[model samples]
Target: MIKKITTDDLRKMQNKEGLILQGCGGDLQEWQDGINELLANENILLDGSKFENCLSFECNGITCLLFPFEENVKLDTGKLAIWRLRSHSTFGGTWLSDYVPNRLGGYLAEQQKPDCPLIGQDGNIFNLMGIASKTLRRNGMADQATEMCERITQTAGSYYEALNIIGEYVNITSAEDADIDEDQGMVM
Candidate 1:
């Protein structure tokens, strides 16, 4: 079974001194070099393997995952793709992107994780995500609040970032603090 690391999981690992890394060693370049060494040690082919491992790290008073997915370094060759997590949505974003995963079977091979991993966000981020989700629901944008939350999670660069974006759509039509009715195209 695959161990899924949620945003809540990252949150729980936080304290005063930022994120504490586990099973990771060396300075910045050395740490990266260590990861490369791990890949070489694994000797796994980049044949689009679905293998993944969560290496935890502390950063800026928060703990984040050093999540690695499988990728092809060369044609018909395989290697482990690595990232600081929280970038699941933008994984393999562009050709110039250092974290770009090799495309196989017409799709970029990436780590299978939640749409809104909330890597950089804290409880405040959670509240922002929730509010965005509720606002979307009250506006009748979608049937499932989970979907709206997922959207917020996927696009929200951070709690403040999402708040600014969602704030635009949140309209108070009356003193009752009622939200606008998107389906009827009217304010309620």
Candidate 2:
């Protein structure tokens, strides 16, 4: 079950029990063998425990492995450090519990609140969408802008629905207002 995931997806995860081996560069097979050897030496490798059972993803150009454990397990930090040094990688394995977010704080922190001026603009849905998409692009969220436009075009049922869809990606505001307080009844 070697699944691939983005760092954003990883950040949103909670209560995940696993061993993460990071900073694996170059030969992935060598890293896998090294990890297996380390685990076997530590008596952590069970009959089903293998490199194939780990989730694989790349973070910042380095490969990472997540060996998900159904039961609580512990690895020797001293030996893990030695393995990391032997592998010549700057980073090493850690309990996934250390990275798992216990609350919604991480997700909230990552949320983007790009503002769009929809007030007193052409009430036409396309025009409003263009404004919101441009705002998203200006905020360096061009992917989000594209996704929002696609979602609106495919799913919006009416003008109000289109406005609601636009609102999901950006804060609707007045073009004349430069410093509108978000706390002061700004439409979401």
Candidate No. with top lDDT? 2
Candidate 2 regions off by >4 Å? 71-91, 100-188
Give, for candidate 1, the lowest lDDT window spanning 10 residues: 96-105
Runs in model 1 lying further than 4 Å from the true structure:
1-6, 9-21, 25-29, 45-65, 71-188
Clashing pairs in 1: 18-61, 18-62, 19-58, 19-62, 20-58, 45-78, 46-78
Task: Give TM-scores for every candidate, taking all chains together and pairing residue i with residue i.
Answer: 0.26, 0.44
Instruction: Encode model 2's per-residue lDDT on 2-42: one tens digit a residue.
Output: 56665555664554556677766776666667777767776
lDDT, candidate 2, equals 0.68
Candidate 2 backbone overlaps, count: 0
Q: What is the clash count for each candidate, in the order shown?
A: 7, 0
Candidate 1 residue-wise lDDT, 1-188, digit = tens = 22434332333332211112333333444544444454455563234332244344343344333434324232222222233233235331122122112211122333222222223334475665665465556545443456446556787777576655544444312322322233456444
State the displacement of the C-alpha of residue 57, model 2, in Å, after optimal TM-score superposition: 3.3
Could you say which candidate leads in TM-score? Answer: 2
